[model samples]
Target: MFQIGRIIMPSPLLRRLLAALVLVTLALPSAAAADCYVHYKAKRTNPYGLHYGIIRVSGGCPSSPGGLVQSRISSGGWTILNVVKVTTSSPSSSERRSAGSHYYR
Candidate 1:
């Protein structure tokens, strides 16, 4: 039978390399990370006090750019405070959407 001695590796070097990789990744900005959009809804009423509009929850990831999962903007749940009224000069082009946007927890 043949046995090999225990081989040890430096921990500091590995840690440094990992840290560098993380820094590089974060430094490079992408089109991700929303910046507080809007969740414009019909609000059950309108500027003209009319109740003849549509109600929907589209996309609103600009209200809270930092909106994140397990925090504010999540997929499994919904936020009431983020709900708002959708406004458009063209009456035919108005619809509701989500307010806050986030990535993951």
Candidate 2:
């Protein structure tokens, strides 16, 4: 047991465990932020189609990773709507259900 200011504290082992937990929690954000998942809306002209999908962006991010998104979507002849969101995590297949085959396959 210990006392800090006027507050009583737990045993030294408990304090060390708490300190380790705090350090791990503090480190989580950087681990989570290490990857980039870009989500965007895109369209096609002739047949008139729209889609929302995700892509993994290499390097950091862009004001518009339009070129990155465009390259992937372009294979299907779709034009981009600029990156709507850049995230640190990728969407799970279950979460991508709405996007169907257009997902980050």
Candidate 3:
């Protein structure tokens, strides 16, 4: 038997359930910190071109993902124009098609 404030919790099963709930609560933040997807528009000038892309960013999504996206694609000489969206879900088939060669980069 355990007393929590004015409530009495008497069952061992209830204690186990409470313990599990606490553990899952503690785990929520780390789960939320998992990798995220960034959808963005970029441009490369020479011949002059534009593309839309979806990229997986590990360690979680930033409040502002533009700088990170620019850095990742800079090696290919692409400049990020704007972030279209950020989400935990992968891009849909239509989105992947739109991204074309830029998909998952």
Candidate 4:
């Protein structure tokens, strides 16, 4: 028997279930923060071109991934136009194919 605040938990099975639930709850955040996918559009002047691609971002997705996307593409002289979507899952095979050479593995 265990007393947690004003509640009495008398069953070992209940205690085990509660412990497992707590463990899962604690782990959810880290799992969610593990990886983020950013889909964006970018452009380059001079030669004049546009690109749509997806990139995997570590350290989780930010409220605004534009800056991060910009920095990642800017090295190639591409300027970020907009962040189309930010998600926790990887892009589908079709999405990846559409990105062509611009997709980051």
Residue 11 of model 4 has an lDDT of 88
**Clashes by residue pair, model 3:** none
lDDT order of candidates, top first: 3, 4, 2, 1
TM-score of each: 0.21, 0.57, 0.78, 0.78
| lDDT, candidate 3, 1-105, per-residue tens | 888999987789888999999999999988888889999999999768899999998878898899989989999989999999999887899999999999889
Give the per-residue Cα lDDT of candidate 4 at 52.
94
What lDDT score is found at residue 29 in candidate 1?
52
Which prediction has the highest TM-score against the true structure? 3
Quality of model 3 by C-alpha lDDT: 0.91
So what's the TM-score on candidate 3?
0.78
Q: Which candidate order results from sorting by TM-score in descending order?
A: 3, 4, 2, 1
Query: Which residue pairs show collisions in model 4?
Result: none
Ten contiguous residues with the weakest lDDT in model 1:
96-105
Q: Model 2 over residues 11-91: C-alpha lDDT tens digits?
A: 989989999999999988776557577888899998998888887765556656778788888888899976777776678
lDDT of 1 by residue, 1-105 (tens): 233467555477777998999988996653243233223222112233211222222233333332332133223343323333332222232232211222111
The lDDT per prediction is 0.34, 0.78, 0.91, 0.88
Enumerate clash totals for all models, in the order shown. Answer: 11, 0, 0, 0
